[model samples]
Target: MDDGVRNTREWSPPPPASPSLVVRSPRQTVSRLRTRRTHRDWDPSLGRPSFAARDHGPKPSEVYGFVGSITTVIATAVYLAWAYTPEPCLRSLGITYVPSKYWALAVPSFVIVAVALSMVIYIGLNFLATPPPTSFSTMFDENSRERMAFSPAMEEERPIEPILDIGVVQINNLMFGDT
Candidate 1:
């Protein structure tokens, strides 16, 4: 190589990126656009995940306990109504409860049973219903416990603040002369 001629081999620049070259396919481009749109559309006000959306998985113990409680309550009510027919008691008091021969003691007993059963069902449902756990142990156990420990009283107390707008009322009165 001649000393006067500059060495071209060590001084080569990288080729410029072509504007026409497709780095990403059409499907990928569409998917990225859709994802951006979805993120933009989400409302910031909805703070937490819903109960149905949480990934705790199905708890068979809870389901079975609820069903069993309901069944037991119904069976107890039915037994009580059958054992306490008013006809015998009324006869002991020297008064006929139902003079009509058509209306048997069993009719009243069935009605009482149905009413008692309904009450039992309502009670069982209320007692057995468990509110879903607020946080998943794997994702947020430590953070949630720290938050809870910081505000122990807040758990028992109402979290919502009262909306007292005395300033708003004064402004309204100034605008439209107090009626």
Candidate 2:
């Protein structure tokens, strides 16, 4: 009978997580200690803060970004002046510590080339590291999980499968097969 077949199928509830499996950390202990220390002056049973702190000024990152952008803009202006301004004008202005004018043209071009080369190298590395078309990993790997099976009738109502990794052969058959 169908019931006999169902009974024969292996069925067991997942085991409960053991105490040994639970992970404890010094960070959690330190956090608890800090909380207890902060609440020592007042009983926390009422659930109210002792004092509210006011908003601090701009964060360190915001300050850094503002300074960095200003510095870059100033440096760019100086570089442009040094590179494009005539040598007589620079001499007349009593500014002579600037480096060779040739560097201004070369440095930006070199940076552009380096960025483009880095992009190409990154794409090449990705292509080299990717699994081939015939590799079994295309179907399943250590991280691959099986899709939960459902009744054939239920398939019609469900619009999407849980997993999205459709096989090349399946796609090819779907798109180009005989009706």
User: TM per model?
Assistant: 0.20, 0.52
**lDDT by residue for model 1 over 70-142, one digit each (tens)?**
9999987855644555667758767654454434467677899999999999999976674445534423433
Model 1 regions lying over 4 Å from their true place: 1-53, 56-58, 87-179
The best candidate in terms of TM-score: 2
Model 1 RMSD vs true structure: 26.3
- In model 2, which range of ten residues has the least summed lDDT? 4-13
Candidate with maximal lDDT: 2
Runs in model 2 lying further than 4 Å from the true structure: 1-55, 143-179
Writing each residue's lDDT as its tens digit, candidate 2 over 143-164 gives 6655556788876687676664
- The clash numbers for all candidates, in the given order, read 0, 0
- lDDT for every model? 0.59, 0.73
